[model samples]
Every structure is written in structure tokens, then in C-alpha cells.
Target: MTTVNRSARGRKSLAALVCGALAAGGLAAAGVTTSLAPGAANASSHREAPLISGQPQYDNTDVYAFVSPDKPDTTTIVANWLPFEEPAGGPNFYRFAKDARYDIHIDSDGDAQGDLLYRWTFKDHVRNGDTFLHNTGPVTSLDDPDLNITQTYDIELLRLRNQHVISTTKIADDVPVAPSNVGKASMPDYAKLREQAIRQLPDGSTAFAGQADDPFFLDLRVFDLLYGGDLSEVGRDTLKGYNVNTIALQVPSDHIRQSVGQPVIGIWSTTHRRNASGHWTQVSRLGMPLVNEVVVPLNAKDRFNASSPWNDADFLPFVTKPELPKLIEAIYKIDAPQEPRNDLVSVFLTGVKDLNQPPNVRPAEALRLNTAIPPASEPKRLGVLDGDNAGFPNGRRLTDDVIDISLQVVEGELLGQKNDLGDAVNANDQPFGDAFPYVALPASGSNGPLAQGQGGGNRSQLEGGSAELTASAGDNGTLVTTSLVAAGAGIVLVGLGLAWWRMRRRDGAVL
Candidate 1:
């Protein structure tokens, strides 16, 4: 009887530790997570590695999968690339790298190896390269002659066994890609262009490739010493105005599932680039948010991106003994979870038992989803933690609040801590789409924050009736004073520089 009591207490204590560790880890790491806006929550996978961070075009920022809410018989996978796109960026706006292969891999049987692969390869075209303009005029349609820069992509489905390709089938070709949301001036009806890009594939699937507002929302300020070093700067959405290039596909459930009996499937996305030697190299890999960003050590971050799920054992140590929790403990004075964090292994690697886990599941880092589980009518941001089984960690939905859910779970919600730890960023800046290709429309370049000294159209004219330049009676005097101050500062700087040079010369230092 005493042994049983002690065992129960130990479990409870361990749960508390795990909860605290998770919260601390989240607060200390990349400090970003899922969105909580109505519809689907955006999951983060942005610039998690040094090598991939340098190559935005080939970076796989986020991957989302869920049973299509409208079409319950199918599953949709949305993968985003090129993080933090400035909407105002023009002429050379973002697009998928033509030289790279963007692939979505599925482990249908839970062997930690992908049994099916959906690959997208893009090709760019410029109707008139001589023009610096992205569009000659308003792009009435995707094929508008005014649209100078355009892109098309092909989709190929490959069946794999034992990591070797067994069969390849072309499902789509020459499909028009949804161009960037250049602005209201260029794309008069951007949503119409996006819808037009949504093609009905020969394989009875739906495909779209184009720019979308970055769905992931979180307070990235946690990196500033866990939020202004005192948690004051907590609620702002750091990615509110950014954009990402998205590739979405909604396919019949039966197409990718192993069998009706094994309904659970694991999904992940990777980007491979062709080197100068023409050898393809996997540069970015994403399955779950915050894995590469915080879980893996810096030295192994690049390696993790290039690795496959089947070989995830090499990274087991990081999950078992995460460094984030320890850092959190040191700073927050919270107890870190004990080593051998099997709870995390189950959540991050293998799917949780009886929820999304496959029978005899092999531990691996892939987002697992049970297609058999119908979509939730009214989804909760907290996901399964809130008893909403259809949400993230089941397979990410654009609306599942992964950041809060993950932080709460790590804070011990699963083990019964009942904590509500989160980054306080509840929803995305924009609402997600209700139908297929459910991400929010990309933010327009013309609609972003105004530049310094720029005035809005509605700004009242100055006293001189000129909004462009505000004239003042003291303008000449002000200019003279500013110039004198500048000249005085420059003279002072020059004098300091000459004195420093003389000192250096006296010390026989190099010039």
C-alpha cells in the first residue's frame, strides 16, 4: 500500500516537473508557436537552422495537415516556404526556387520512412524581362499579358518502399502558380487570381502554389531575454505583416493511406536544392514546430535539416535531455523535467498513444494525423489538450494554437498540472480562409506600414497647400541650425580621429 502511494506521488511530481520544463523551454527558445485565430491555427517552422536560414527560397517554413472540414472524405496538406516576406517587396518578389524540389513525405505505415512522396518542381517565366515592373498593368487573370513575371509548376506523386522509389506518376503539369499579392493596383482581384491558380488535377486532387499571409502567429519577443527581460513585451504578433509562399494540396484520403485499418499517417515536408555539382542536397526539413528551432543544439541543427525521420534516433538525446528546459530553470528558478523525457519523445517523435499513434509505432519526428477522426465542427485552439482531438499534434490545422498548446503541455497539462502558460498571442492578425487552401490571403505591398516621411492619401494639406513638403516660416533658420550642428559634429569627429591616429602612431600601432 505504501509503495503504491509513493509511486502515485512520484508520477504527480514528474508531471509537475514536465509542465514547468515545457513552459520554461517555450519561453526561452524561439518563443513562437501556433496561431489561435478562427478557422485553423498557423504553426511555426521559420528559419530554425543557420544553413537553411541563409536560403529563404529553399526554406520550408511550416507544414500543416488536417482532414478537410468541408470535404471530410479528404485530407489537405499545406506547406509554406520563404519566411517573413515583406509584402512591399517588388520587382523581385518571393517565389519558390526553380532549382529546388519541394516535397511532402508521408509515413503511411509508421515505419519512420515515407511510403509516399508528393514532389513539386517550379519553373519561372518572364514575358518581358526588359521591363523592371513585375506587371505591365492590372493582372486581370493569371495568363494576363500584363503580368510580366509568372511561374508554373508540376506535381509528381511517387510511391516508396524501404526509402526507395517504387513508382512515379505525373499528377499535374504546367499548372499556373498564384502570383504574389503585388498590390491592389496590379492584382485588382487577388483572391480571384488565387482561386484561378487552384487547379483540379488529373488525379482528382486540388493544388495551389503561391504567396499567402504567414499564418503562424506568436510573440517572437521572447527571444529578447524571455520578453523584454521581464515579460512586459508579450502580446505583440511579430509576424503580423509578413508573408510566405505556400503550396497546398487536398487529396482523397484513400490515395495516401496505407489501408483502411491503419488510418493514422505521419506527414513532413523537405526542400532539396541542386548544388553547382548538380547533386541534390536536402537543406530544410520540418515536421513539428520548435524542433529544429529550440530542441536541437546549434552544432546539430544543420544535420537535423538534412536527416530523415527513419534516422531520428541520432537526435533522441536532444529530446530526452533538452537544453531549453535547463536554461529556463536557470533563469526562472523552475524545476527542469528529469532526464529521459519519454513524455516529449511521445509528443514530438511518436504520436500520443490511442490518439494518433499507429499500431506498434516507431519513434520518429513526423506530424501524425488520424484521417479516420472526422474534423472538429468547432475546433479549439488548445487542440487535443482541450479534448479537441482533430487539432494539432493530431495533424496541424491552420487554426490550432500550437504555441499555447505546446507551452501548456510542456507546463504539465497532459500530466495534470492544469497550467495555462502561453505567449499571450491568441490569434493571427488576419482570419484564415473557410474553404480549401485555407490560409489567409497574402498582405498587399501597398497596404503595409508607411515609410518614414511618407503621408497617407487622406492626410490634410499643409499651410502651403503641399502635402509632399511641409513648408514652415522658420524652415531656413532650422536648416541653417541643422547644418551648423552637423558641421560642428563632423569637425569634432575629425579631431577625435586625428587624435586617435596620433596616439596610435605614438604607440607604433598599424594604421
Candidate 2:
């Protein structure tokens, strides 16, 4: 009894500290800025943490949940992994880690603990290991014999109450995974392959697992001395050509909600990889975008990944008093929101009341969505900030401009200080699909120049072998294509960078 009381008191104190940090100030308190300050931002959890960055196959890069637009009665949850995958990366193309358990968790009763979970376990196969090619010929279908490598997955649905598993059911099995978009020659009709991969489960839900263009767009050059040292290099989409392994599920709205009375639900995704001792250890976790990237400090990053939201109290200090805004204040010389930022708490931990917050909500990091809300007729990229409640902070959508919205909110936009802070990059490089599995098609390998050494080029050759790398014509004068790997080798050429890379590589699991 005393312990419960003490815990309650501690929570109240923390809430008070956060709520009182930002006094209700008007436009006057927020100094007028003639020109909006350029903000520093990165891809939503793409290579965000130290440990997960090294294990891309098990990295939960981004998660999106929104009421399906076409099928308004259903909701879609899209989670991505293996960030920064080169489209032409063959010889050993990327696939979901067979030894990892990729899971999507849902909290229906606002307990900060998942009441339901969908688990995916993969099995990789090689039809012809004798050859080095991903595919021997044009891959017209998912089961084409020419495809040397393939993967199939099974899905299990687990129902939990108070963190104790009540039941576990196998929802899907032997679902073919959509192969990577190797190129035109290998996968001449990739769309048909993706369509074939989509499966209708025993439950009234749709599932798809495959490669897709990374939907989250932002200038990663912010790490380049905060954008070329003066914020000048901001508009280029750093992840333009990259792809990610995606797991997209669309389920009936009523399936995930606690009850008709309780419409809001929290969603997050995690990746657990089997260690050497045959123990499944969680290595990556993601809920809200940028929480791991900008909010959590460097020291507790790995710990945060292994933690569940029910125990988020240990991470309260990071959310209450974040470090990104302080760095923004220091570098850009712009006043940041006051300490113990309750506004952020409202956004990240607890859902905004009268908006997406569930009943008796517990403060934790998860993407809260009001299942009752319908899709917007014309979705606004700024989301709720732009008066579109059907978007982010209400369960993110594919087209939500989270970078600009996060920047503005971090700069005190919600606290009545209207600011237009942004990173200049507006939208994704590729267009998203209009239906289920809304992410864009993965970029093809035949689109650009081959990687440095792959194209018969070397530093020893004069003029960097530009002559050998020229475009060629195939049979009947048809243009032959190759992919360009924009390998930024300059960063590794520096002495300090080399040391940092070696240290980070040694710190995490190499595979």
C-alpha cells in the first residue's frame, strides 16, 4: 500500500514539473521572427541508435498507423526495417532476418502495455546457391524458378492481459514475401509480384511483407555540421534512392479497439533477434518518430530499445527535458521551449486530451490513434497542426510531413507561438501507393550508374575510369541500365571518422 502511494506521488510530481515548465504565454512572450529559423532533423529512426544502426536487418526504422483511406472501416499499420538498402545490392540482396522476431504491438486500454501483438518469423531459402545472381532470368512471378533466393513468413497473433499471455494463435503461414526490385531485367513486372505477395489471412485482415521505397523523407545532412555548417544544404532528400523491408497489415477497425466506448489505441513495433545462446534479445524499438533519434540521449539508447513502454517511467526525464531543442538553441541561436517540456510530453508520452488520449491514459511513448476518426478528404501534411486530425499524433499516415511538424512543435508552435520552422525538404522522393501497403515501389537497380568498384572503375586508373563506365546499348540497340551507389566515402577518409566507425562497429553485433 505504501509503495503504491509513493509511486503515485512520484508521478504527480513529475507531471507537475513538466506541466509548469512552460507557462501559458501569448504571442508577445514568443518573440516575432521575421524569417523562420531553419531546423535540424533526420529520417524517422533511420540508423538512429548506436546498436540498432549496426544491425540494420533487425532495426525498426519507422512505423505508421492510420485508418485506411480506401477501406475506411479498416486500419493499416506499416512498419519498416533494414534502412539505407541499396536497390542494386545483389550477390546477397537484403531480406527480413530469419533469426529475428518482428512484432507489432497494440495497446487498446491505455495501460502503456500491449494488449495484442502480431508476430512475424521468416524462413529464407536459396533455390540455386551454385550461382551468384539473385535471379537467373526475368522474374515474372513470386515463385519463378529463376529467382535464386526467396523468403516465406508465418504470423502469430498473441492476446495479452496485464502483460501475461492469455492465448496465442497462428494467424498466417507460408505467405510468400515479395522479392526486392532487383532491376528491369530481373523483375520486369515488380508490381504484379507485389500484388501476388499480398495475402488475405484467416482473420479479416490483409498482410504484405516486402521491399518498399523508404517513405520517410528528410535531409540527413543535418549531421553534416548542421547542414553544411550554415543550414544551406537542406532541401536534398538524403534517402532518395534507399529502400526498406516493409511489413504492412490492414485490419478491421473494431478488431484492435478495446470496445466501442474506447476508440483510441496505441501502436509500436519491436525487433528481437536470437543471440548466440538461443535467447531472443530485443535490439530495436520504435514508436513515435524522432524519439530515439533526437529525444533520448546517447547513453540510454540501447537500454531504451530493449525496454517496454509499461516501464517508461525510467525514461521520463529524457522526455520531460529533451536535448534536441537545447542543441537547436545553441547552434541556431533561437530560443528553445523551456525545460520540462510538457507539450512534448503531451505529444510523445500521453496523447493529447480531447484528441487522441485514451481513458485513464498512462504516460508512455506510442503512436496513439483515434480509431473512430475517418480519413481526411484532403490530407494535410502538417497533420493536426494544420487542422487535420486524421494524421500523425493521431496515428501517422504515409504522406504526413513529420519532419516539419516535429520541428514546429519542438519550436513551441503548439504553445501558441506560431512558427514555420522546417528543414526545407517537403515530400518523399517517390509517390506512395493509394491502397493497402501504401509505401512506394522499391527503386530498381537498373535506374542509375553502378557502385564504384562494381562498374570496373579504380583510383589507379587515370580520369577515374570514366571511359569504362560509359552507358551501353544492348541487343537491338536497347539501352542497358545500371544503378549508381552514391557512396559518400569522404566521411570515412578522415582520421576521426575512421576511429569513430571502428569503435561503433566493435560496440555492436557485426551481423
lDDT of 1: 0.77
Pairs that clash in candidate 1: 19-411, 19-412, 34-403, 40-398, 40-399, 41-398, 41-399, 41-400
Question: For each candidate, what TM-score against the reference?
Answer: 0.81, 0.81
lDDT of 2 by residue, 219-262 (tens): 87777756776789788776777788999999998999999899
Over 4 Å off in model 1, which ranges? 1-43, 449-511
Which predicted model would earn the best lDDT? 2
What clash pairs does model 2 have?
Answer: 448-482, 449-483, 449-484
Query: So what's the TM-score on candidate 1?
Result: 0.81
lDDT of 2 at 114: 94
TM-score of candidate 2 versus the correct structure, residues matched by position: 0.81
